[model samples]
Target: MAKIAVVAANGKAAKKIITEAVNRGFEVTAFGRRAENDTDAKNYIQKDIFDLTREDLKGYDAVVDAFGAWTAETLPLHSKTTQHLADILSGTDVRLLVVGGAGSLYVNPEHTIQVADGENFPEAFKPLAQAMAAALSELRKRKDVKWTYISPAADFQAEGERSGKYILAGEEFTLNPAGESVISYADYAIAMVDEIESGKHIQERISVVGA
Candidate 1:
């Protein structure tokens, strides 16, 4: 079975990914700063994201980076952490999958207007959004590392039913039949794990939306 390690494993999205991976019969290890003992995984580790070494990460088929920071002061950690993972996993078979933000998604077909620059984007979240965008930029520069960034829809929700249905798009924001950009975290997790298993979008930034 494929072994997967989920960083920031206790976060809502990470938890759902862990559950979904385990349900699909993959071996999962939950890595978090707090290291909860109650997760339904094969293993759990409490460690800082930067402290993870190539040796420590060996044997896992893939690693999902579910880390997030809200404040402007802590937002830079996003790029820093991405660099660390890229440095450590460079030339290795382990793939890095980032849980990215929608701010980087292009608002138009010409690739002109990111969601972060859109008028409706909340000011309070712009820092975090910009930080995630920076992380994706950094990842793009690492050609030796195998990585995929999955950006959720602009209306990504924490509480919604897992219909087990979603549409995946490349870089651009995906909209459902209602012309709304939205996706539930549960379904996002499903798409994420599906990519890990399929390796369909390696070295690409993909977006997910409700079907």
Candidate 2:
């Protein structure tokens, strides 16, 4: 069985991922700030994310980073927490799978512009977007760590339906057949668990949209 660790396991996305991985029979350990009474995973690690060390994560095949920060002060924690995990997992065999932001995905084929740079992007979300973008940027520089950044579509919905269907794409942003860029937290979880089992996009960033 694949031994997996999910950070910030109480979050909507992480909870869905935990449920999916557990239902698939993967040995999943959930890491969160507090113990979850209703967590799907049997194993749990209740501790501050930054306080976690490599020894705490030893023997896992992959670690899913579902950490999130939306405020001006907390937004920087996105990159900080990613760097912390990268440092701890450096030179290890464990794969670092990050729950990335779509804002950083390229808007054009030339890769010169990102979704966050677009005028249509919301001003309120730019700080969080830039922080996540920075995290992906710094993560790419670490050749020693095995990392895969997965960006969800522009209209990521927590309450959206889980058709268990999605289109996985490369760096450039993409839309589905209906001309929509959207995905549910449940569907995105399917992609994350699939990646964990397949390991097809190591050291690369991939995006997912509803199919």
- Candidate that would win on TM-score: 2
Residue 41, candidate 2: Cα error in Å is 0.8
Per-residue lDDT of model 2, residues 147-166, tens digit only:
99999999999999989899
Q: Model 1 over residues 25-68: C-alpha lDDT tens digits?
A: 99999988994645678799989999999998898999999998
Clashing pairs in 2: none
lDDT for residue 90 in candidate 1, whole number 0-100:
93
- lDDT of every predicted structure (CA atoms): 0.90, 0.94
Model 1: residues with Cα > 4 Å off, grouped in runs: none
List TM-score per model, in order: 0.97, 0.98
Stretches of model 2 off by over 4 angstroms after superposition: none
